[model samples]
Target: MSGRKLRQLKEAMATILDDLNRGDLFSIVVFSEKVEVWDPALGEAEMQDNLGRLRDWTESTTDAERSGTPAPSVITAITLENTNKAKRFVQNLTTYSATNIHGALMKALQILEVGRSASPEQTNHAEERPEPMIIFLTDGQANVGVSDTFRIVSSVTAANAGNSSIFSLALGNGADFPFLKKLSLRNSGFARKIYEASDTALQLTDFYRQVASPLLANVTFRYQPDQVEPQSVTRLAFRRFFSGSELVVAGRLHGNNVTGEVQAHSSSGSARYPFDPVILPTTPTANTMERLWAYLTIQQLLEDDDASTSPGKQRALELALTYSFVTPLTSLVVVRPDNETRPVEPEEASFAAADRSRAPSHVSPVSLSSFPVQGAAKTSHNAYSRILPGGYQDMRPISSSGAYYADLILPAYPVSTSASLDDILWLSPNDTTVSLPTGVNGTSEVLNLATADETNAAYAACVTPGGQPGHCRHLKYCVLLTFLNNQTEFLPFFCRIDSFVGVCCQDDS
Candidate 1:
């Protein structure tokens, strides 16, 4: 990757970190001749003592300020907010001699595997399988090493299933879109092409934050009657961001009692489920109208029009105008048609042209007084047992610290394995005053607090935190609430490891 493109990736990643919930994890793997692991970013730290525990290590160590900074580029711009956490978790990314994409995909899966196995606390905390993801951004095709493109593609597709969604972004004109699309589509993901380098950063950023943030995971639609299919009602697409994202499902309704159920599982074992089934009322109001015009507007933008193409484009425009004019609700129930083979006009065909053009922004007014609303009743009486673990447990093999960079091994393929940085530092977060790892300081290099750290905190805070015997977030899982020096809690935030800041800041991406 060029310096310009690398910087662009960093900037785009920063945009996503700030918007993510604390529990989500995002990994960015940059594959050239080597591989790198960029970990999750940190939220704001809480206030603590001025002379932090790590101050002792700095006493013997010469201040970079006093010793003169290494170089102008030594201090990477800490511009992104939650990057502090990510920098600490990921360290010492490896460098290689060849750009092997197949190798990179395998390495990404390994990192996730290691993360999953690293902590019993994490495993215990998670309600379901971690929704892992791999956003592979490459500018060229597989040119070096094992170059069997078909086998490479098939292997990657099979590897990515269930565990992660692989989104491949092809940068510059050199990228092969057909190949990239095949790889992404095969693995329940998609491929996007950047027209040029200028468009790379923003698109990459959008793909990370907007598309990745709202996870519409476990999306399934069920409908009966061959005449009324839900898939035909509205076209549906799913995008996965960090961890928790809303599933947007909008489509034309073809019958009365139209029901739509959407459910998402949180880090807590609890499930956030929403079910909608409403009768198709005949009386239409301003609030009852659907915004089908927006869909039509998208269709218009997708068309190619010229002087000779005037008539065809005009017909599309006219239909859009009619749809906007009538402001049709999604409901389009038809028991039986007068003619079976007649091409059905869009629900918008019932409107006038002038009214369509004069239409106001679609806004609905819902009156709660007339509609019945239901609330979720509590099934259990006890809140404490429902949320927090009832016991206190301490971590074993207390101290573990070292810095060694080596290749990450993928269990399935030895040839595809590559090196990555894994730094496991330890820290203790007690009530009132929290302490970082002995030598760790700042957000860039974090002291890897083990699963023990998370487990200990759960015991200290929930099971034995003074008078109130209650859970932290209240959902049946051990919650690791890392209180920064400032007394603020930092939830898990996700970011690319290549952009990760730390002591051994190798060019991972």
Candidate 2:
């Protein structure tokens, strides 16, 4: 996470600490290259006086000067008064090099295990067993020890042993969302992506509140075999259902009818709930259920093993193709008209390839030139018109293998037909202004064109309608103009073309 994002995370953590209830048992485990837990001294506190001392210690450790210092510890239980200590711990968190995801999970599982093993006198057992959960937050890929997704999942499974659930929060664009989603799904938890924008803290806090509430645990579902057989169900049972959470089961119908009753077991074998028998349409035109089933099956396949060569992956690709659903394995191809003869440049080719690999299959690429130019109606007064010579043109044809459509246009400058070399005024560096020289006739008057500041301002005005600055367009045009003005041979090539016409279009057409 960036420094600003880290601060937002701290604020979110503080909110969580503030909302913690009296009976709630919590632990703060912050990790980067290493894992750090609150001081053991804070955990040993039995009286209200010790709580004050714990808070003081936390505040001292979180001092700005001490932010760079690293501490080595594991986990500390949070009490009523120690909430401040937890908040302090979160506030002091600083960015560290390398992400040790495996280490973090292992440490969290170990802490939960210790909590479960605590004596009855130390932890009340008659009320209920505290649901052990780890809220894993990360903004980058794992680069430290045991970085493999499968290896990390295996380690988490062994350490967790069905005792703890991992709720993952992927922060920013750099986060590996798919990997985190798989990790959470395997552990019977939830996963969410936190975009890089304002109100991230609110989003984090809202997500925390949802995961904090557990309506049910250790849920299992059973369907009638004669009516419908469970071809594929959500791997992680609905172990932790929140207030607004929905439980959906997708399976294939055995006969022509889709009628079955579902039996649900919850609370670690203590309670049972039976759902009403479902009656689906027999001759429905739209196969909504089948499509839903395919989606769930694909998710399970991806969660199980995402290796391209794996059988599960192959099956997922086949299912996606059969259902006409876009998947990571497939790329959408667009056919252009025969008259469009624009060639794909090297930069555009690279851009298309990268975009295709990352973007979701359903979303098509949009042409950059297709976007309307701001203040285009008044091109004469518009500063951007002077900077971008060609203005807007159709994008080059995209490669079929590329993911999204390639829509970037190479920079082109306008060639002047009426204006001669002498008509262009040189900008004086001392005064930072442009002035046209007097005509051959003595009666002709000099005219000022623009100031250096205005020319510089034109660079920012050259932007796409979507509000993206056209830095490449401005830079390339500037370079071409400078070359034409300085080199005598290039002057002949540019002289014959009209000032309003693009050199690239003239040569290509």
Candidate 3:
């Protein structure tokens, strides 16, 4: 993972830490080769010492981390002091070893179990309290302990006695979205892929806000038997309900009307939102209700991945197509219904292949471009635009082949001192340079530098919209171009490349 992403992760943690109040009880579990519960109260020096012990334990060099001396496990009650400590802890974290996803989750669940058993509110069923939540963050697949995806899923399910919600944040392209989604779906949560970009921290913090406030816990909706089709109901049971969001319970009623009740445990006490019997037709927008049910059904079915749900997936696809909705099962397609496809316009590039008028320079007699026989009608080479990976390149129609693209030729002439430059670099079609030897006292030789370098942190960056590695290069050399004003839409940096103001971009579009 990039250091940029790691910094954003730290920022997100800081945001969450700052947002929490005294009511929140939190513990962090990060695992790679071994599992460890992070103590928010520990100072940086102490934490690093403990971390060293944990590392040695992983390597079998020491038993200090695993032995009878139970490592400090401080399930922190949110306070300004604890929050600052936690932020420091998060800031110092570094990615290491192979991911131990199973171990990490099990460790988190164990922490939650400890917290639950120790809490007075948990013991009192009537007392409303914050439901246990596990915000699992990882960048890549589990490659260490209990790596088998299915095995890990089953083991986690078995270990999670509290049925604590696991919101999985997949931080980059290396993550397995399907696996995370499956795990979360099985454990009363969901998965979100945080794309690596400029606003990565915002994405993380925004997601945290959605799950931060627990308005109700153990939420469920119930209706009288025969009033609504039981199988048709859309996720009646929920782990928790958050503030500023509707907990929709959708189902197809057997008749026109039905009575139901929403049962939940809120912050105050046991709560029941009971509904009285009413005619379904009292709702004027009948189609709206049907659409809502269809929407919910599509969402639920698409999320389910059980092999038996193949038919359900198909039904979801049908509903998505019928309703013109984009879902996992369906993609949004743009069709040119009128066959009104825009034709690519043609363009041309002309070069004086050989400097016909050279100032005191003797050169080769041959030229890449031939001059029209004096007085003969000038034959024009119309360069039809060829769609390229980087962009359009000039192409001219040849009799033999359908069309032929030309090699990029820049302004150059065979000089007296050397027939060729010390560097004869063949530039790309998008390139606008040619290497040559130095001239008079004031002149200088040409230089061709690489697009990116790890040594120069300022020059190294991801310039592509999709977050692929790229670096700043001259507009003429950089095939893919984006507006300088629209820097926020793409990568992090731009720089100078020789005489040109460089834009960060890869060689390809």
Candidate 4:
């Protein structure tokens, strides 16, 4: 972390300590290559006293670090007292060698479990269970012990044992968004990304406040048959729900049914909050609810696919293609006119006449036509654009050749006028590659691009400073390309397509 980021984290931690209620139980676990828990054996009263001491210590250390002194080791622990220990721990945290995410998470889980078992009296009371949860924060990929994402997630899940929820905060652009998101989703919590900025402290505080307010826990949504029975129902269970958040569930009707009853099951499982379902008049309007349901279902299936189930993977692909989503199983193929090729001028084509001196001798030029072509299929962009409000008409128009162009919007930088098609690549769910179309044409013969790994390797070799692969490992499937007026001016730039409903943007270089 940068000095600015460290300061922001300290500020956020102070705010969190201030916001905590007196009866609330909390713990802090910090890890680099090893884990450290501050005040591990301190009781409630002793912990509070330790917190005061920690506050003074942290202030002194902060002053030293700000004066150009090297940062000290991490200080972390858990507590139930209203003390500044958590704040001081955050302030004293320093960037270390490798990120031991698995160790940190495992240690947290152990603490929660120990707390639960050690206090059976408190565990018996629903309100006194302490709402065991792990708020995991990380800024980089796991490079220490048990670095494999799936293994780490599985270990966390097993450690949770359905008693605790894991709320993950991915700090900065380097954090693995997908890994954190999936981890939280599977464990009955949610993941959020915290971008590095001046207001990062404020963002962290707000997120803490939101997660701190849990209106309901272990919630389940069920549909009861009143007039008719539905053909199927999607799984509707969440580990925790915030005070102001909304929960939506969607399903299909078996017949021409109009009325049904939906019930919500919460902590008091027997008590059901029932409501008469309302069916809005179906017109030519976009089916936002249905699409949302599909997206959620696909997300669940993808998470389940981590278990190596082939059926779940197949179902996710089916939904993605049905909705025109670019998933691991499908690629977005852009078709343009085959006659749009530019001719090489005789003078410009001559090796001697060309500006060879400006080009690197060690690097070889790659042609867009080098990619293979596949067949074309007709599809709409509605599935991809439904996340945005308004309606289908608000979407950008499809080109006459049936090509869909999505504008890449970035808040920090100006949008590119045109992006090289060579820059467009497909990223699979597992961060593996399926295929990348080098270029596309309106003709029946579509370009069949190289596999994701091959394309990434080639692109990495040419773009990376060290000519090493995996340098662009963070590159996702969602790519924003520059829109050029003439296709012949550069290689065809394709949009980063995904199985989910969201906009794509350029990678943070």
Q: List the lowest-lDDT window of 10 residues for candidate 4.
A: 369-378
Overall lDDT per candidate, in order of appearance: 0.36, 0.48, 0.54, 0.46
Residue 502 accuracy (lDDT) in model 3: 44
Candidate 3, lDDT over the whole model: 0.54
* Candidate 3, 215-303: lDDT as tens digits: 88898877788766677667777787665334445566666546667788888778998765323123442233444456667777877
- List clash counts for every candidate, in order: 28, 4, 0, 16
Task: Give the clash total for candidate 1.
Answer: 28
**Candidate 3 collision pairs:** none
lDDT of 4 by residue, 289-327 (tens): 555445556756876666555888888876765554444
With candidate 3 superimposed using the best TM-score fit, by how many Å does residue 467's alpha carbon deviate from the native? 13
Superposed on all Cα atoms, the candidates' RMSDs to the truth, in angstroms, are 25.3, 20.4, 21.6, 17.7
Give the TM-score of each candidate. Answer: 0.41, 0.57, 0.60, 0.56
lDDT of 1 by residue, 247-283 (tens): 2233343444343333334445334444444332444
- Better model by lDDT: candidate 2 vs candidate 3: 3
CA-RMSD of model 4: 17.7
lDDT of 2 by residue, 317-431 (tens): 7776655554566543333465443433332121111111111223221111001112111001111111111211222324343233333333344432333334323323343
RMSD of 3: 21.6
Question: Which residue runs does candidate 1 get wrong by more than 4 Å?
Answer: 13-21, 26-28, 36-98, 118-130, 161-163, 195-199, 224-227, 230-255, 268-509
